[model samples]
Target: MSTLEIKDLHVSIDTDQGNVPILRGVTLTINTGETHAIMGPNGSGKSTLAATIAGHPRYRVDGGSILLDGEDVLSMSVDERARAGLFLAMQYPVEVPGVTMTNFLRTAKTALDGEAPSLRHWTRDVKKAMGDLRIDADFAQRNVNEGFSGGEKKRVEILQLELFHPRFAILDETDSGLDVDALKIVSEGVNREHAKGGMGTLLITHYTRILRYIKPDFVHVFIAGRIAEQGGPELADRLEEEGYDRFTAVEA
Candidate 1:
């Protein structure tokens, strides 16, 4: 199985105030078929970690290395990371004004795979995935995320995850802005794709509700740009009961 390893990663971003450090010597490893959850309060740098892994331009690597199967991921370009099987589902998806969803997905799949998928198979697979995600068939004809609701955009992100079949998926608070029903649907979509046993998942969220549907093999508590605690699924249960009060208290 392939592995994505982050080693003592330090990251910072430029703000009006100047370069501000967001991640401080953070490290983790995930293998295909493993599900890891990152839980923390706002400003704890969960999304920063996700963006860094996806090679976002806003975040600069100050120190440390990210490796995907021993390849220097930090050295690769953003699209190179995706081609290398790294995927990120943003906290807020942006709209592409002119690109239709069908064209966009096919183009991306072609880029990732270095060839076009068979028309017959691609059509069938896209239809099946959209149906499974409960997305309206007409969404295929719409521009990417254009005028869609928050929940719709999030589901579309999972649609890409399902279609692209990345080795590692970094979901940055996908649970946000989703109601109970949408939450279950989106979580089930993630779980369905993950069940194939070929994709490692890094699910970042603040609540335990999504954990109820998408169980994580490991749960990490992020505090002040570092991992303050780590444990198995049971740790999620405890976090649900006690919240991050104790951890933040310790940090304080």
Candidate 2:
């Protein structure tokens, strides 16, 4: 079974003043068939944690280690990490003007599997995933995220998640910029993936609405780049009702 483990990870970004630390010894783990939610206020390093795991070039890991299935992930290249079954759905997905959805999905599948998917079955699989997300059939022909609405872009990310079937998926603020209907659809798609078994998820969000549908196995309160509290689903409800005031005030 696939598992992701982060051990006292410290991430920083390079600037004119040299490296500025962002994630300070943040650590967590997620096993297969589980869902973990990370909620925090803005600039609390939620996105940085996710991006660092995905090996984004902008973020540098100054300390700690990340392992996937007992393999050292911190030592691998970004594509290597991806081939090792780690996926991150960005908060602000970029628009690839010339790459059609079909092409992008096909390339990703090819890279992940180390072989091209059968053309005969590829269309069917893409169509089925799109249909599940309530995406129009014609979307496959459009350039990735180009000219798409906020909700549509989110759905496209979900589509890629379903198609890729990564062992661990880090969804960063997926519920952001989505309408209630769009959020439900995206959450439903995630639920379907989790039910497939052996697929773990790390969902990062500031709101609890998506949890109403996806239901996290554990909820962690992230404050100041560190996990302040962790508990069952009730933790999510409490945060939604009481807000992060009590938790933030303690540190302040």
- Candidate 2 at 9: error in angstroms? 0.8
Clash count list over all predictions: 0, 0
Best by TM-score: 1
Off by over 4 Å in 2: none
lDDT of 2 at 175: 97
Question: Residue by residue across 38-110, what tens digits does model 2's lDDT show?
Answer: 9999988999999989989999888899999889998999999999889898999999999998889999999
- Against the reference, the lDDT scores of all candidates come to 0.96, 0.92
Residue pairs clashing, model 2: none
True-structure RMSD, every candidate: 0.8, 1.0
TM-score of each: 0.98, 0.97
